[model samples]
Target chain A: EAGVAQSPRYKIIEKRQSVAFWCNPISGHATLYWYQQILGQGPKLLIQFQNNGVVDDSQLPKDRFSAERLKGVDSTLKIQPAKLEDSAVYLCASSGEGSGNTIYFGEGSWLTVV
Target chain B: SQKIEQNSEALNIQEGKTATLTCNYTNYSPAYLQWYRQDPGRGPVFLLLIRENEKEKRKERLKVTFDTTLKQSLFHITASQPADSATYLCALGLDRGSTLGRLYFGRGTQLTVWP
Candidate 1:
């Protein structure tokens, strides 16, 4: 019954600093996803992992953003040399492998770059 | 490029009235669509899902209608209440034969119900 869990609910960093966010998906969920949500905007997916292997990462900024779900139960998203534009909420979500399964989201990690 | 569009403006309606929100997409076809509710400072919560072949879906007070030809999905809340006020998001599921977990999101439409 527990939902997805994220760490460091709020973060503040200067431009060019590096930030990392951690997420633990719901129990028994095999698919995990990372999404970014800017103010006044909807959440955009950054990457997806299916049991420790990446399913999709086409939208991830390879040069700056990196994510891994080595064991498949949890995930970490890192942003290096963060920019002002990186100020947004980092959301972690998960779902079962079956079709039509509902995706559950965490409380989100809020990042602010000044 | 693929794009999803939702009303950027906030919708204000009476608490007893029905609230209707629109979501439109262009440049790509999805096999299914989903609606989510997002409160301030919280992540999105799934509300409903409707596949391309389906015309309408309902969950309690929530209803969703999808039109593949029009590339549009409509979400309605009947007998709305102040507690139902929040930003609503529409996400496009993967195209047929692709992975089903991936989704693309819109900017979301904010709704406020007044007493």
Candidate 2:
């Protein structure tokens, strides 16, 4: 089976600019997630969507970051007025309907804000 | 808040040897734990999961042991190879009356196996 798919494997943006990353999860997956991985750190969840409805977004920076899963199959994460600290890898992952199921991740979109 | 920690120092082992990584968590009781392998510039790939009731789980040459008393998990890779070199992450799943619980991940342990 095909794994999660992501776009723009790499992205470079200037501070104050805006950037977006796209993701297509595995077929039939019911849960989608966006995580930000800074250097030398684990993936920090930015948001989670369960069938287009948000499950959790407590860690997300609402002032600068936004994400949406329109049909519950694909998702987009956007960051406006990007800062140098925003430089990191944006990883998209998906899982089946149960808590025990393993989550599969995409290659991730690398973002470098200069 | 829950806090997870893995070894910050990189582990170096010779090929064919066994490599063990440790993960510890505090301030939370997780129902399950998961392990993942991540390579440079790539997202993490699922490796294994061990439930709270399960003391140990194995898949091929990989073994995971969870100890609730200590609130720690240990991941072991046997017959290690150079290809096994990567960052290994441990995630704690805390249930909240949902089929899928939220995951809190550790910083990860980097393992380097040399031939």
Candidate 3:
């Protein structure tokens, strides 16, 4: 079966510019997540979507980061007025219903804010 | 909030030897824990999962042991290989109400097996 799919494997933007990453999860998976992984650190969850509804987004910086999973299949994560500190890999992952947290991840979208 | 800790630095060993990694968590005892393998610049791949009730679980040459008393988990790879070199991450599944099954990760342990 095909794994999670992400776009723009790499991205670069100015500090004040905006950037967005897209994701297409595995077929039939109902749970989708976006995580930010900095160098030398584990993936930190930014948001989670169960179907089209948000399950959790406590860690996301609402002032800058926004994500949407329209129709519950495709998701987009956006970072506006990007900061130099926003440079990191944006990883999209998915898990099927009743999978019990066994998430499968995409390769990731690398972002470098200059 | 749960704080998870993995082997803090890189572990290097010769090929054909066994490599063991540790993960410790402070606070509540998770109902289940998971391990993942992440290569440089890539996303993590699911490796294994061990439940609170399960003392040990194995797959091929990989084995995982969970000890609730010590609040730790041990991951072992037998007959290590160069291809096994990567960052290994341990995740705790938070079993709260709306956040049930949410995962929190530890700083991974980098393991390198040289020929």
Candidate 4:
């Protein structure tokens, strides 16, 4: 079976510019997630979607970051007015319905903000 | 505040030897824990999961032990190979009386196996 798919494997933008990342999860997966991984750090959960509805986004930066999963199959994460700290890898992952379900991740979209 | 911590330093081991990694957490009682393997510039791949009720789980040459009393998880890779060189992350799953819960991850332990 195919794993999670992500687009624009790498991206570069200037500070204060805007950037977006797209993700297509595995077939039949019910849960999708977006995570940000800074260099030398673990992936931090940014948002989670369960079939077109948000499950959790408490850690999301409301002022600068937003994400949506309209159809429950695909998702997009956007960051506006990017800052130098926003330079990190955006990872998209998908899982089944249970907490014990294994999460599969994409190669991730690398962003470099100047 | 809840915190999950793994050794930030890299671990170096010779091939054919056993490699051990530790994950420690504070201020949280997780229902389950998971281990993931990550390569440079790539996302993490799920390796194993152990429940709080279970003390140990194994897959192939990998073994994971969860100690709730100590709030720690130990990951062991047996007969390690050079190919096993990568970062290993430990995540804790918080159960909110539902099938889904949030996962808090550690900074990960980098393991380097040399031939």
Candidate 5:
């Protein structure tokens, strides 16, 4: 079985610019998540989607960050007016329905904002 | 407000020895906990899961013990190997109205095995 997939394994952007990351979860998975991993820290969940409906997004920076999972298969995370502090790895994860939190993560998209 | 913590520093161990890591949480009464292995520059991979009622769970060479009373979880690897070197993370499944499980992860503890 294929694992979670992410695009642009690496991304470089300038402060004040815009950047977006994409994720393709495993087949038949209904729960999708986006996490931000800053250096020297664990991945922090930014948003979660359950079949195209957002279940949680309490940690996301609504002022600058947004995410969408249209149709609930793939997801996209976007950051506008990126700041230098935004530099980090963006990881996408997925799990099946009622799986009890056994999430599978993607390789992640490394973002460096200069 | 829940907080999860793992060792912030890396653990260096000799090959063929056993490696053990600890995770502690505060202000959370999780129903289940999970462990994941993450390599540098990669996403974390699922390792094992242990519920509140389960004291221990094991895979080939990996074992996890969860103690809810202590609010701690321990991850152990037997017969350590160089390939086993990676960061290990502990996650707590938050109860949010029976919604799909949402996890809160710790910073992770890096383990390095030397031959």
Candidate 6:
């Protein structure tokens, strides 16, 4: 079975520019999540979606960050007016229905903001 | 605020020896803890999950122990190999009922196995 897929494995952008990353979760997975991992740090949850509806996005920066899971299978995360501090690996993950279940993650999209 | 911590030091062990990594957390109660392995330039892969009600869980050569009172979990890989050299991450599932499945992760520990 194929794992989660992400687009543009690496991206470079200027401080004021905008960037976007895409993710395709595993087949039949209902829970999708977006996380940002700074260098030398663990991943921080940015948003989560269950199907076409958002489950949690308390950590997302509304001013610059936005994400949508259209059709409940593919997702896109966007950061407008990116800052240098936004340089990090954007990771996407998916899971089934339970909290104790295993979650599958994509290779991640690495962003470097200048 | 809830916090998760893992050993920042790189664990070096012989290829045939067992490798043990530690994860500890403070504040907030978690219903389950999970372990994941990550290679450089890659995302984490799920390794194991242990619930608070369960004291131990094993998957082949991998074993996990959870101590809720101490707020700690230990991951052990027996007969370790060089291929097992990677960053190990621990995560806690924040429960708010209905299994929303939000996880808080720890800074992973790097492991190296010597031949």
Candidate 6, CAPRI quality class derived from DockQ:
medium
DockQ winner, 1 or 4? 1
- Per-residue lDDT tens digits for candidate 2, residues A8-94, read 899999999999999999998889999899999889889999989999999999999999999979999999989999999999999
State the lDDT at B96 in candidate 2.
44
List per-candidate RMSD values in Å: 1.5, 1.5, 1.8, 1.4, 1.7, 1.6
Worst 10 residues of 1 chain A by lDDT: A94-103
lDDT of each: 0.91, 0.91, 0.92, 0.92, 0.90, 0.92
Which has the better DockQ: candidate 2, or candidate 3? 2
Which candidate has the highest DockQ of all? 6
Alpha-carbon runs more than 4 Å astray in model 5: A98-101, B96-99
Candidate 1 scores an fnat of 0.80
Candidate 4, number of clashes = 0
DockQ of each: 0.77, 0.73, 0.65, 0.76, 0.72, 0.78
lDDT of 1 at A20: 93
- A1-114, model 1: which lDDT tens digit per residue? 789999989999999999999999988888899999999888888999988999889999999999999887889999999999999999999988553548899999999999
Across B1-115, the per-residue lDDT of candidate 2 in tens digits comes to 7689897659999999999999999997998999999999789999999989999999999999999999999999999999999999999888745556468888899999999
lDDT of 4 by residue, B1-115 (tens): 8888896569999999999999999998999999999999889999999989999999999999999999999999999999999999999988745445568889999999999
Number of the candidate with higher DockQ, 4 or 6: 6
Expressed as tens digits, the lDDT of each residue in B18-109 for candidate 5 is 99999999999888888999998789988898988899999999999999889999999999999999999888886645554568889889
Kindly report which residue pairs in candidate 6 clash with one another.
Answer: none
A1-114 in candidate 3: lDDT tens per residue?
A: 899999999998999899999999999998899999998888999999999999889999999999999899999999998999999999999998655557999999999999
